[model samples]
Each structure stands twice: as structure tokens, then as C-alpha cells.
Target: MFQGMPLAGAQAGGGIVSLIVPLVLMVAIFYFLMIRPQNKKQKQRNAMLNQLKKGDKIVTIGGLHGTIAEITDDVVVLRVNDVTKLTFDRNAISSAVSRETAVE
Candidate 1:
């Protein structure tokens, strides 16, 4: 038999709650510092993809630049040159460049 030992581990000052508070704060800090901005950027990218239309200039993930000649539910026809047209998935378009931005 153990003689005169603290009956519970919680006898340590600021037991479970003190241990848990810092962990919760760390998770919250990570959410704000890392996760939130990533989610916001992804939302902006999704919004841009949805707003794509014919005649919009886009850059593909592969770094190829083209003008959208046609659009469908899942495909885009990009005219890279007078004689070069390529079909790509809508997701392959990385970003769009407006005439104003492209000229600058």
C-alpha cells in the first residue's frame, strides 16, 4: 500500500485545464496564421475560374499563355497563336490576365 501519496494526478496545480488551454490556443493560432489565408486564396481562385469567359486571356499551370476561344462545362479552347489552338481542362487554367494587366 502507498502511504500518504496524492490520491489523484490532478493534485498537481492547474491539472487538465491548464494542460488543455495552451493546446487549444496553439490550434487557434495555427488556424489564423496558416489555414485561414490559404482558404481565402483558394476561394478567390475558385471565383476567378467560375467567372472565366470567352476572349479572356489566361495562363495555364504549365505557363502557356492563350486567349479563350471557347468554353464548355469542363473544357476550354485556348488560342495560343494564329494556327495553334489547344483544348485544356478548366482546372488547367492557373490564372487570368486582363488586357490592362497584360500590357503593363
Candidate 2:
């Protein structure tokens, strides 16, 4: 005869705590490992974009290198060569090249 039944209340509390603890740990790990670094990089990139000016040599995300010929609100004109100029969005620029590097 199977007449021994465990009370529901005792098991429910442990079950809830076990589920909640892992969910909280997962969120904390994701924030530190993934979200935090991505946000920091975005802030740095935004600062670089805002400081762009004429004669700053830069490389685009597409690997083109050029000097900033002009800057508008959201666009950039790049002089890749003496007669070759290209236009791109400000966000397309990756990083600025130093004057020494630009000369070489």
C-alpha cells in the first residue's frame, strides 16, 4: 500500500530558491562578461567620433585609409589620394591614424 505522501509546502520552498539562485547568477555573469565591455567600447568609440576633425587620418570599417577632408553633422569626406575622395557616414570610421603613420 503506497500511503506515504510528502507534504507539498516543504518541497515548494526549496524548489523556488533553487530556481531563483541560478537565474540571478546567470544574469550577473552575463553583465560582467558581455554587456559591460561592450558598453565601454561603445563609449570610447563615441568619444573618438565626436572629436573628429580635418586632417585626421583614419581607417574605415571597410579597411580604407584616408585623411579627413571635411566633417559634417553625420557624414565625412575622406581624401584617399590626391584626386580620389570618398564620402562615408561618421560611424563607419574605426580609428584615427597618427600623423607619423599617415605620412608613411
CA lDDT, every prediction?
Answer: 0.93, 0.93
User: For candidate 1, what is the TM-score?
Assistant: 0.85
**Candidate 1 off by > 4 Å:** 1-13
Question: Which pairs of residues collide in model 1?
Answer: none
Residue 98 displacement (Å), model 2:
1.7
lDDT of 1 at 65: 94
lDDT of 2 at 99: 80
**Tens-place lDDT digits, model 2, residues 41-103:** 999999999999998999999999999999998999999999999999999999998887676
Per-residue lDDT of 1-104 in model 1, one digit per residue for the tens? 77767668656566778889999999999999999999999999999999999999999999999999999989999999899999999999999998898742
Per-candidate TM-scores read 0.85, 0.89
